[model samples]
Target: MAEPHPVLITPEWDAPATVRALCTTRHGGVSTGPWGEFNLALHVEDDSAAVAQNRKSLLKACDGLEQIQWLNQTHSPRCITADGNSLPEADAAETDHAALACAVLTADCLPVLFCDETGSQVAAAHAGWRGLLDGVLVNTVKQFRAEPETLHAWLGPCIRQPRFEVGAEVRVAFVERFVGPSRAEIENCFSAAGEPGKFLCDLATLAALQLRALGLSRVSDCGLCTVDDPRFYSYRQHNPCGRFASLIYRLP
Candidate 1:
């Protein structure tokens, strides 16, 4: 007789009072089977009606959101300003409008939330390896009207290094571009996996390094690994899995 209260990860940072941010875990929704509770994405072909209800529960939890400006994330370096209209094909979305949440969905990949010191703007980005290496966070930072020092970024749950094995090429692609002190930092992001020509990559560390390079000293990480943490969905664990969302917005 009562709606399931969705379990959300609220960022514990020094963001302004008006700035609100949250990440959903795989708890408290109507989807059955592998989706098992709060799955918010509609594109995975989980029953459309169930997904719709999950979203509705999400909406109820936020209450008064004009819209959750969602993107059709494509692992590209694309970031856009959310207009509260149609869903755009981008890895990131930002909005200055009050009550409109900028949103991105993810399973194993990173979900990054951003807000300015003044709480006047907010953004969300989806950063898979390709998107991260291709500069999706770069594009997201560009959308901010404030200087990098005035911004705060919160990195959400993702596949951590020990659980995220990748080929040597992934390591090369990330480390080769940097040759200074930063190069060593990048190199440290990976460790040789048990198998040859493979390395365990740390997506969150890479994201933080990139963010810090972009001049955001205020970056914070939720320190959650989706694969190791049973509360969130993991694409590597189950294909066609549900996607949890990372959302941020300014209050009206």
Candidate 2:
């Protein structure tokens, strides 16, 4: 028998007024096979019925099923402010609009949820390596219309440093984008992998650097490693695994 689905909540550092955030695990939904139970992604090969049930369960666990803006992530820096039922094809979603939740699906990519401390806005992003390298996080902060320093960031579960391998070209891309002595801080986020032309990348640290560069010092990470933790889905560890969801909503 499959285990019950698990739901992970962020700490107080991320709990802005009316902002409710949670990351669902693979344990609770109705998906079977490699996506066994609780796979919320409609793009996966799971039974449509199973995916529906998983989504239903997730909505019940997080908030009432009104309408959440689910993005069609393309690993790009694009972000859209959604107001209705239209599922926009973008990498991030945000709103000061009440009752409409913002969400993203992920296996190993970083799912970042954001809200201004003043409860004026909320947003979520699927920041995979490509998205991150291309400035998705920075673009996300801009969506709130506040100085990046006033926003709070909570990084959901993702593949950790020891398991996230990247090429030298990836590092070069980041170095070229970053400014000042902080260039070394970005480089230090990578470690020498045994393989040439490759290094171990730290997604969390990279995100922190980006947040710091934007002057946001209140970022807090959940510290859960998707690849290292079996309770969550991990694309790097299991290529065919189902994706879990990270959702955020503001109360009316």
Candidate 3:
């Protein structure tokens, strides 16, 4: 009601003018306390009515978005085509139809949006550690009919390397999962935290490497850190935090 906080982000990429994308911050919603304002996720124990109202406000703010297909986001590599008629259980979604939005919800996990230079199709992926390790980015690239080189990707805000500390298993996961001449390059994205066996992972850098591995040359990042930025909801900072939305759609 009070100007909706106005924290939406438009990604900088080589996407055509017909492609529309934005990432919402934790402002401009009716939820109270922990959920605070502008929490778009329904699974985070926020009041259903409040979440509904917040979602409605989001729709009003984004022009030319007829419908946004919200996924369950199981942190898997599963991706599907958005039809705007049914809610699916997947981490990524894409659409060629105009005004049908492909959306994903995240608090700390990386949200990656995709589009071809031709502006014919657009996609959004929820790339958490598990999803990223499982190849969600690779699978999302496969969904596009165009060559991977022609597709452009934009990395949204997430937990940065300084705050995202993980166990040794996380480091092993990437090292073991991606073994090659460039494996060391991938390994460089993780560094030992102050604690032994604990490591700080750069999710954005890992995501960029994954995109480059997929032959996508046009990749850009919003460079916003969710944990450090109070404008966003950080699950690591608060267990019962709200979730934000990263969405993309084609304009008619």
Candidate 4:
């Protein structure tokens, strides 16, 4: 059974009054078993009717949100401009349209919400390790009409550094993006795990670094970890877990 009221985490950045952003927690919905309740992703094998009902409830919970309008999220760097109705094959989405939210679904993967300093546009990106390494955030940033320096971003909950163990190959791949002293900063985001050839990666810090590199000075986070925090879902902790959302939109 779903909770009477769904819990939402609003970003604590300095965005203008015209822009709004939030991330959903796994506390409201009607899926059973591992999905339990509050499961938002339909592709996770949750009951179709229940999922639809949950989605409807989500719309009702959100004051003027028109729809979630999920992307196919292929883990590629693809980002698309959305119109609030078309489901596209991309990992990120952006829009200036009011009431039509841009959203990304995630379990353990990082979901990022973005908006211009003046609140003219907004975007959401699903950044799994692959997508993050592949520049999904970069592509999402490019969709904004505002300069990178004029953007504010909020990092949603995900598997944090202490629990996000990655192979050496992943670290090597990410390191390849940098070449000098800046590379050391990126390298600091990955610490050696107790296990040989494994490293614990700080997904949020890594994301913040990339955003800073892009000139976005106002990056903030929910400061929560998905696997350790029951408020959000974690695919690493529950392999068949449901996905939650991080979303943004303009208000008319």
Candidate 5:
């Protein structure tokens, strides 16, 4: 077994054997400034060497670095399958290979890990409000060949509803896409911000709703609030912040 790094572990329905999943906390790398200690994002202003070292550290924590598939996230609803040969430029990655891993990076956006209890497949997604509104979760499950009931999901760390304030336009966008009690559900996800047209939104609950809409009955979330938790790197709290990652893979 690999030694535990100072990170957050999120276990889905399959705990010990079928698969493993985790989201890194900004607690154990060589980054500085707003990026702080454990920034894994390449696009951030942190030194490339530091980012590389952080990645290496993460790989070590996860046991090995053979086939981890990292995506270039754009906050779109695009999801893809990856192998060791090539990388995909999308928000989510799913795979059935034991050696291959699927990963998603985020600061405040929701990072979702999906897998079957039987260890048949696994997927990871980065779902910002934009992606959620545009059907990213729905698209991700659609890409999964596994039956919905057989799938288990885990929501990693993200901005909490209390700290994630948004404008009315953002609420309207989600309202337009969501139906039924979804209006209330969507409204309930938001708390009243001091401003007239603004509200505090809950990314986790929104993601859970999305997963449930996709027929995934088994969903669990870490409930770790990025913006509120100092251990996490939050873009909303710090304007220029680093990104942590949520990764999933079947054991080889």
Candidate 6:
């Protein structure tokens, strides 16, 4: 039998050979309408059976991946070690174990994948605006005992700056976290949305900034916008949409 060619995205980074990663697109599954196909998330009203089948397809695409340690993300800064069992209620997870996938589900939210230069550790974080401002990326990086300079990060599809209009409080939330010269850097992530109190936020840029702030120099972005790209799911574009999965694991 021929291998199924489901639409998957590989990160463009100089990661070690043992680290494997991919992001699923909304194609090649048994879902219908809003969920379309390949909807891996179960919390978005997608059919349970369809979600199961889609998840199975994802695992198949990973080849030897034993299991994807899924998280019940709540836009918090909590991160846990990926143990291959027990779905933890956290926004990020990391693991140094081979064949154990650390994964996160996202529609418009930014999904960041991490791995060290030696491929001994890998992690995935779901960073919505709230989670980003709350330090989810920082928490994920902290899990790896390796030096931050030795890590590589990949920023996945998310709502772009032009479409991510946020209230003044959203801008304030991030700005309040920085001080002096650093405040200007965080403030640059937001631009006026033409409304009095609204601003356009670049989620990927913000995530990259966070990664760089943690001493990670090699950060690459997929540059795919979930809201503008038809291949991926976008909650901002389709209200009751499903989520795509960004997963990373080590090869044994």
TM-score of each: 0.96, 0.93, 0.96, 0.95, 0.92, 0.96
Worst 10 residues of 6 by lDDT: 177-186
Query: Candidate 6, residues 132-198: lDDT per residue as tens digits?
Result: 8888999999999899999999999999999999999999988997322278888898999898999
Taking all chains together, the TM-score of candidate 2 against the true structure is 0.93
Instruction: Tell me the deviation in Å of residue 233 in model 4.
Output: 1.0
Please give the lDDT score for candidate 5.
0.82
Candidate 5 residue-pair clash tally? 0
Query: What is the C-alpha lDDT profile of model 1 across 90-167, one tens digit per residue?
Result: 999998999999999999999999999999989999999999988889899999999988999999999998899999
* Predicted structure 1: lDDT: 0.89
Candidate 3: misplaced stretches above 4 Å? 1-6, 179-181
**Local distance difference test, candidate 2:** 0.82
lDDT of 2 at 128: 90
lDDT, model 4: 0.85
C-alpha root-mean-square deviation, each candidate: 1.5, 2.3, 1.5, 1.8, 2.8, 1.8
> lDDT per residue, candidate 4, 161-186, as tens digits?
99999999999888896322277887
Q: Per-residue lDDT for 65 in model 5?
A: 43
Residue 181 CA displacement from its true place in model 1, Å: 7.6
Q: What is the lDDT of residue 81 in candidate 5?
A: 88
Instruction: Score candidate 4 by TM-score against the native.
Output: 0.95
Residue 243 error for model 1, in Å? 0.7
Error of 5 at 83 (Å): 2.2
Instruction: Count steric clashes of candidate 1.
Output: 0
